[model samples]
Every structure is written in structure tokens, then in C-alpha cells.
Target: MKILYINAMGPYEAWPQAGVFVSERVAALRKNGVDVTACSYYQINSPAVQRVVTRNGGPDLGTPIAQQAGVTYGIRKIPNGFFSAAMQRFRPNFWEKRIARQVRRDMEESKADLIHLHWIWPMGLGVMRYCRETGVPYVLTCHGGDIYSDMKDMRKRPYILKMLEGAAAVEFVSKALLESAKELGYSGKNAAVVYNGIRTSVFYPARQEHPGKTVVGFAGVMILRKGIDYLPEIFRRIQELIPGEIHFYMIGSGVLREEIEKKMAGLPVDFLGTIPSEKLAERFNEMDILLLPSRQEGYGCVIKEAQACGAVPIGRDVDGIREAVDGFGSLIAYTGDDDAFISAFAEETAAYVSGEKPIDRAAMEAQAARCSWEERQKDSIAIYQRILGKAD
Candidate 1:
């Protein structure tokens, strides 16, 4: 079957680490003999677009790139600020017709059996409109921000609900997110919880010998949603409780990097900007624990990545983190309780230092193994086959 995977974020060469799961999924589907292709809207600040903007000294709509994987069409980006938000709120369908026009053209050209839309914000709405007009079936995957953040604005709820209702199937990365969709009045048919998967060959555990101190790590975009502001306080408390030299490796970069670095000064933290996937796996192996205190997460992919590398995951008990750490690691603190979080961190670190809470490396690997890309591919293909009423 021919399947078209539509993503707002393009999985391109410029951003090596971006859309990793999407790339892996497309590759897996192709390997399984499914004719799968990807299409994305040109991200405004993407490396390619930024290069053009830098050369021209202004934003310009450029030609989209066509590759064996799929095509990426350029689209106007809403400017960042209050004005943009207000415009989006007031004129929700401002870009809908344009995006849908492009998507409809692409769909007709590809002659796809089904379309799989990644996020349900602007893209899903447009694609849903196109699909409805042409009587083509499509599945929608609500990846957190679109549902939890975007849909929070009642203005966008009707469109989101309509897209969900019109989908051939709706998939979420976590059960928590699925429930959240239901709570937001998504009474859709063929709803399923399909956890995101990791490429195990690249993320598997590597044995490492620690000479003295245990290292705790955090990997992902260092943003507000990640609860990075709380890291310094938690680390400070953990240090006071544990006598050993504990070090923190912050593995990713974002808008709050400088501020977070300033706040973490005088602490044993190393801001390792951004490491490649292979090196990231090695870094994960070096860590005794991985901290992901996200205030909100669609699914904590880092939790699984760290776990796959045999690092024990310690995260806030919220949304996807709660589910990811269910059988593999420890979940600490009620969400938003700083004091409780500090206490939990202190306890976990103290136990680790004392060798009382040793991580079960084998079990961690096993749990992570269950989340392999091959398995996810099989599950996804099964969903597609079911949607199309065909047998494998």
C-alpha cells in the first residue's frame, strides 16, 4: 500500500537529530515493502530556510526540496509574539485553504492509499479538509502540544475535534495523551495508543566503569516545558544529601540554555551543548541516572533512550513520563510540588551513592527492547492494514 506521512517538521539533512522517530518509521515501513513517503511543510527557521534568510537579509518563500523520501513544501510561518497568537486565535483558518490546496495537489500526485498526519494543529486540519473533499482516508496522531497546548484555546477545539472525528484512526504516543484527547471531547473511532519507538542498534547500552563519582544526566531541549528551571534546586538538594561528587550532564540546547547555565553556576553541571546520536548513546552509558522532570510531555522519548542505554530514569510523575517509567525506573514527586521533588531526588541519589538502589541494567534494556522500531513498525502496519481492510 502507498502511504503518505505528513509532518510539519521536515526530517532533513540540516537537522540531523530532528524528526528521528519519523525518519525511522518511514525507513522501517519501506523495509517492510510498504511504499511509504514523507512530506513536510518547510519549517521557517530550519537550517535551509535560515541559510536563505541569512543570504537575503529577509525571509523569502523558496522552492521546496524533493527527495526519494518525499517532498517539503514551503509555507508562511506565523511570526513569534503576542500578535501572532492573537491572529491565530482570531483567524484560525488563515492558512488552512493554502495548506490544504498544496496537500490536495500532493495527495493526488502520490496516489496514496492512506495519509498519516503527525500533529493535529494546522496540518491535520488542512489535510483533513483535503481528505474529506476527495474521500481519501487518513489517520491523525496527536503529539502533545497540538492537543494539550493548542486545543486549550477553545477557539481551536472545534477544528481539532472535527479532524479527530474525521480521521480513519487516531493514534497517540501515550495512554495519558489518549485520555486527554477523550477529555477534550474527541469521541473518535479507531483510537489507539501507539508508543513511539527508538532505533535500538543506535541506542543500546554500553558498559562503562566509573572511577569515583556518579553522574546524573538530562538530555533533550532545555526549555520551560522540560522543567529545567527546577533542575538547579533539585541538584543542590541532592548534593547536600549525598556526600560524593555528583555531576550533571545537560545534553541538549535550547532558548533557555544561557539562563539555565547562569542559574546552574557554582553547581557541578556540565552543559554539553548537543551530541550526535552515537555519542549520545555513549554519554547515556556513562550516566548513573537520567532526570526528566518535565511539567508536561507527550511521551518522554529521552526516558526510553536513556533506559535503553542502561541509565536509570528518574522523572516527575506526569503524563508520559509516568507511563514510560512504570516498569523500568523511578517516578518522583507529585507534579508541581518542588519540595516533594527535592525530597525524592535526595532519597534516590542517597540510595544510589550508598549502592542500595542499584539500577537493574538487564531489566532496563529488556523494557527498552520492547520499544524497538521494528515492533512499532509492525504495530503501525497492522493499524494501516486494519484501516484499509486488507491482510498482511
Candidate 2:
């Protein structure tokens, strides 16, 4: 099968967390004997664009375009400058406008059997328009943020409804995401759940010795959406109650680092500062728990990554997080109930810390293995085959 797989970000090295699923899936499909052409938006913010376009610094396009692993990777540059900026205002969906020409170009050039789009917002909407006009078939996959953003703000709800309506098939990372879209009036018949897969090769059961400390770690950008405010308060409360049984380690940096530092002052916290993906599994292995009280998620692949290393996860029971933590870890209600959250965290890790409840490393590893990319691709190829048969 020949597939044109498109998404908002790419080339894994530049946007690791955002591009990983696509990158990995492309490799998996290629391994299974599918001809896949991967395309992504090589964008820089206006400031970076100004720096490059004005000849002040290097170019704004991220990561040099490459073709590797039997998959031809393509880059679509979003044009810059005054006329382009003015041109953008005329379009209701700015991203759709930026991506339309590129999407059309890709479609005409590829002669692909199917087009698999990663998100509903920009790429899917553009593809929807193309399919409606050109009679080409494409599939849409909702990866959390794309659908979640429109759920609260009804301005772009029609675009989402139309995009979902036109797709030959629709995919979701979790069942929760599909239901949420239905709440937004997505009555699509072809939609199904395909959980995001973890790299078990990097993350597996190899418990590192932390020696008398119940290390609970948080690994993600420190931002408002990650439920960052709740971290400091939870840390203080847990420390006051548990009193020296736990040590907090925060990973990844963002705009709120200094603010979080100020709040976490004098606490037993270690700011390791953005560990690389290859080295993150080592950190997970040392942890007894992975605490990310995120406000929303499509599916927390990090939860599965940590679980593969035998670190139980304790997070908010909302969106995709609930499914990721269903049988593996603990989930507190999404009501932002601090007391309830802290209690769940304490209960989930306390027994492990005291050695009363043994960590079922095999069980956790088994759960993580079940969600591997290799396993998920089987279903993806099945979808591709079905869509192709219908197209024939």
C-alpha cells in the first residue's frame, strides 16, 4: 500500500514529543512493506521568520529536509513577510490558508493510494476541502489538542464537524477523545481508538536503586496546561504528611520555571532540566511514580513509557489520561480536588515505598508492551487496506 501521511510537525529531532508518533509510525509502516511519503509543516514563529526573512540570522525553516528509511519526508514552508501577513487576515482558519496550497501540491504529486492526516484542525481541514473538490479519499486522526481546543470554543466547531464528516475514516488516540468529539456532534461511523505507542526498547523494567527515597518525578514542559500550579502545592502537602519518605524531581523547562522554582523554594526538589529522550528512560527507571496532573491529553505516552520502566503513574482522570492510567496506575477525579489527588498519590506510592506492596514489574511491562507502535500499526494497515479497497 502507498500512503501519504501528513501532520502538523515532524523530523523527530526538532519536535521530539510532537513528532515522535508520526516518525515511529512511518518506520513501522515501511517495515511492514508499505510505501509511505511523510510530509510536515516546517514553521518558525513570526519572530524567527523576521530574523531569517530580514537577513538578521539563520533561516526560519526547522531541520533540513530529508528522505530516509524508505519514506520520502517533505517540508512545506509557510511563506513570510507583509503581503503574506495581510493575506492571512482574509481567511477564517489561518492554518488552513497556510496549508491549502501545500496540501494540494502534495496530493497532485504523490498519486497516493490514501492520505492519513494526523490532526483535525489545519491538515485535516485542508484535506477535507481538497477531497470535497477533487474527489480524493483521506482519513483523519484526532490527536487530543486539535479537537479539545474547539470543544470549549464553538467558533471553529463547524469546521471540525465538517472535517470529521468528510473523512473516509476517523481515528482517535483514546476512546475518551472519540466520545468528547461526539459531544461536539461528531456522528462519524468509521471512527475507532488507536492508542499512542511507547518505545519499549528505550523504556522497560530495569528499576534503578534510589536508596531510601520514594522518587516521584514529573516529566513535561512546565506550563499552565500541564497543571503546574498543582505540583508545588501537592509537593508541600505530601512532604508535610509523609515527611522524608519522598523526594521530588522535576524535568523539562518552560516559561514558568522561575515561578515554579520560587514556589518550590526550600523543598526537597531536584531540577534536572530537560533530559534527552534517550536518557529519559534511566530517569523513569529510578522513579517509583510519574506524576503529571495535566489538564488534558490525547493519550499520555509518557505514562506508558514510565509504566514500561515499572513506575506507576498518578494523574487526573480526564480525557486520554484516564485510559492510559486505567488498570496500570491511579487516577483522581478531574475536579482539581487537591486533597483527593494528594491522597491518591500517597496511597499509590506509600506501600511501594515501605516495601509492603511489591511493584509488579512484569504486569506493568506487559501493559506497556500491549500498546507498542508495532502492535498499533497492524490496526493502522488494516484501516489503510479497508480505505484502499473502498477507493478501488
Highest TM-score scorer = 1
User: Which segments of model 1 are wrong by more than 4 Å?
Assistant: 10-16, 43-87, 390-392
- Tens digits of per-residue lDDT, candidate 2, 54-97, equal 48533233353454323456777665555555554565366675
Reference-based lDDT, each prediction: 0.76, 0.74
* Alpha-carbon shift of residue 177 in model 1 (angstroms): 0.2
Error of 2 at 72 (Å): 7.4
Question: Compared with the true structure, what per-residue lDDT tens digits does model 1 show for residues 1-392?
Answer: 89878766444443335555666677777777889767766434455545655586443333333342232333324332444334666888655776788787777777888999887777776788788888788988777888788888788888888888888888888988988888889884579888888778888878686867778888887778888887888788878877757788998866678888898899888898767778888888888888887888889988888888888888888879988886777877675667877778768867866789877789878888778767787878988999888423
Model 2 stretches with alpha carbons more than 4 Å out: 10-15, 48-72, 80-90, 94-98, 243-246, 334-340, 343-348, 355-359
Worst 10 residues of 1 by lDDT: 67-76
Model 1 clash tally?
A: 0
